[model samples]
Target: MNENEKIREEILNTVNGLSDEQLNANPEKGRWSIIQVLDHLYLMERAITKSIADKLKSDERVQAVDKPIELTVNRDVKVEAPSYVVPSDSFQTLDEVKDKLAESRSAFVQLVHNADENDLEQKSFPHPLFKDLSLKQWIPFVGFHEKRHLLQIEELKSKL
Candidate 1:
């Protein structure tokens, strides 16, 4: 399997069998709960997929940066989630969040599969933190983003 698939599986494994209470409990003040993190992940995934689709349909092309993945996956630089992608309290249960996450992941995987390999390196979109990233870079960036939140989830879980 590819890196995306591997990371997807890891994400599922990380959150699997978590109780609603565990998912909703905040580890500390002014921090996100496990479900909130999942909600953010789903929101960002959908947004990124839409961004890539829009860029693919456009006639514009941009230069692919060297080591774009390195720039995105760096954990040292803290970035705030844009208001558009922030998670809401609409999801009442862990199951609801998981269902949306599964749907978003399916859409993201399909988008990656349907994209042209050659075009992936040519097309670009603005990342909240990384400025501009090619389609190819964005795919793995999703997994890396998930992994970052996975650590947060683990920390939240420990607090319970």
Candidate 2:
């Protein structure tokens, strides 16, 4: 397997065995439950697929995304997605989240291998806390972000 595929397999393996409670529990108020996190992550993967496959262009006016565990907690923003921020949602069940994640993760791993180098470098996307970032940076961010959240989930599980 390729490097991207290897990384994907490792990450997906981690996600596969999550218990229902572990997947559905929220770490904090106004925060995403584990299920929500998976859906949101799937949402992000779709956006990335668009970027890489379509050779997308960003309008300067488009908002940015923030960091992992990244909450804007900002009262000022009213946009559908905070400019430069990841969206959080409340998914009803772990099964629902996992279903979507399975699709998104497969597509994402494929995109990483198929991505055009130029598109990866030239495009910029909004981050919630951090400002704009390139596709190259964003790809790795997905892995790092997932791993971080999994760590959070594991910690929460241990406490239970």
lDDT of 1 by residue, 9-74 (tens): 776787788777777777698888778888998899999899989988998999568455645445
Quote each prediction's TM-score. 0.89, 0.59
**In model 2, which range of ten residues has the least summed lDDT?**
69-78
- In candidate 1, position 149 carries an lDDT of 73
lDDT of 1 at 105: 82
Please name the candidate that would achieve the greatest TM-score relative to the true structure: 1
TM-score for model 1?
0.89
Root-mean-square deviation of every model = 1.9, 6.6
Cα lDDT of model 2 by residue, 1-160, tens digit: 1443454455456656767776677667665555655566577667766655554544333333434423322324332543323645444565676577678778777776776676667666655555676666677766655555555445554543
lDDT of 1 at 121: 94
| Residue 91, candidate 1: C-alpha displacement in angstroms | 5.0
Candidate 2 wrong stretches, greater than 4 Å: 1-22, 25-31, 51-93
Error of 2 at 86 (Å): 7.1
